[model samples]
Target: MDTVTHTFFGLTLYAAVKKEGWSRKEKTAFFVTAVGGSQIPDIDVISSWWDTAGRYQMWHRGLTHSVFLVPIWAALFSAISWLFWKVKGWKLYGLGVLAVLIHDTSDLFNAWGTGYLEPFSTQRITFGTIPIVDLTLWAIMLGGLLYAKLRKISRPHRVYKLVWLLMACHFIAQSAQGYALYEQHAGRYEQFALSAGFVPGQFQMIGKKNGVVEISNATAFTEPKLQVELKSQESADLDKLFAANPKAKTLYEWSPFVVLVDNEKQIGLYDPRFYRNGQSFLFEAIEKDLKQGK
Candidate 1:
């Protein structure tokens, strides 16, 4: 999930739980710690230096995104936050951990999912169930925040409660969307097995890439592509695609990104074409790989 969203959700959750035993100071501490903890997952970006050799070295959504990390990361952040809490440290630590974990959970709803197990297993998770930016959820959550901070209404008012409820609904709806997509391809997983790859897991962002249905596997630094063909009915009137790539088309459906490069011999596809990112560097890399016959 977006950091901003995590922060907002964390803050709202903190506020909602304030009535328990946490004071305003403790709530504030929890919110801050959660925000920081939520960002902890991305610290793996530093591993790009290793990607030069092996893409799996420091996969993005790996162990850092794990549920197990929740306690560890939260405890880590809580310890840092505790240094400043100046009181019963456990409250801040507990609240901080829960809030941060919520932030991680919320992020699983987006396309750029995280890997909860980096040092362990390199797996990414995402549920296209809710778009990275869901307007309705945004409106309700942002509106609620605006009202809480702008309006002079009591914090415990019904309106504030509604915001939390809406956010919760969004999370559930997003999770369901992911599950639905997974089930949609459950039986067909074998069809696309050889051509490309299937995540074979839940909530990973699946997309069309360079004319092939691909799953953005964070396990690969560049996100190796996957190719999955859609059943005729699975596509939007795929009969028309019969003549497209004949061989590939037999399996593919109506995919806009799945275009034939020049419709020539065996070699097609060139979107954003390598030359677009700086021909010299691109050529150098391509040349280097070619020299090695990779």
Candidate 2:
């Protein structure tokens, strides 16, 4: 999920709490715990300032987002809240843990993935069942807020909880549909990657077989539509290119799947899942002529 969505998650969870009998100090403490925990995992981005090996790709969503770090983050946030507000309670710890857990779990659904296991496993786990910026979630949260205000609901907290439930259902449904589509084409392709479209229930599926890549879109209720196709030439040598661009080597190792581009003049690799109309942001290339001199 994106930063805005994560912030909204924190705010929504905090607001969902019943305000009855809660003092201002208690509310402020919980607020910090919620928002801080939600944003804490992304702190790894700061590592870029000190990174010299081009490992920031592997370091951004690295150990900080690990499941093993959840409790540590929660405890750290709780201690900070206690020190700042002098409001000490178990609820603060619990809310902190919940917010951190939500942040890690939600990241797993997007295409960029997360290092949830980190030190234990170097694998980048990703379901790709949800887009980074999901309009569906925004609509659900916004709708809940509007209903709560217009209906004058005495228990708005309950409405927020209901919205969470709806969000879960939405995720499950999207995953199932993507799974089905992947299965339908699995045997025919040697490798495949799935990316959720901006629209709910829509997906972009990329499958590669024998150097040919197929990019298409599908939905649970609609027929799969072919978007574009590209044939990869594997004859181009990549040793020189990889030697020149260490980041390209790292990218090749980090990605679960990739599309190799070798047209003799240049050698490059890109994540096929991110292949847009003509190029991908995740691509790294080096000129073949330059490779010879290095």
Tens digits of per-residue lDDT for model 1, 64-122: 66777778877777666657774346766776677657766765655445555444644
For model 2, state the Cα shift of residue 136 in Å. 0.6
Best by TM-score: 2
* Best by the lDDT measure: 2
Candidate 2: stretches off by over 4 Å:
290-294
The clash count of every prediction, one per candidate, is 13, 0
Candidate 2 structure, TM-score to reference = 0.94
lDDT of each: 0.49, 0.87
Which consecutive 10 residues in model 1 have the weakest lDDT in total?
A: 279-288
Error of 2 at 4 (Å): 0.6
TM-score of 1: 0.58
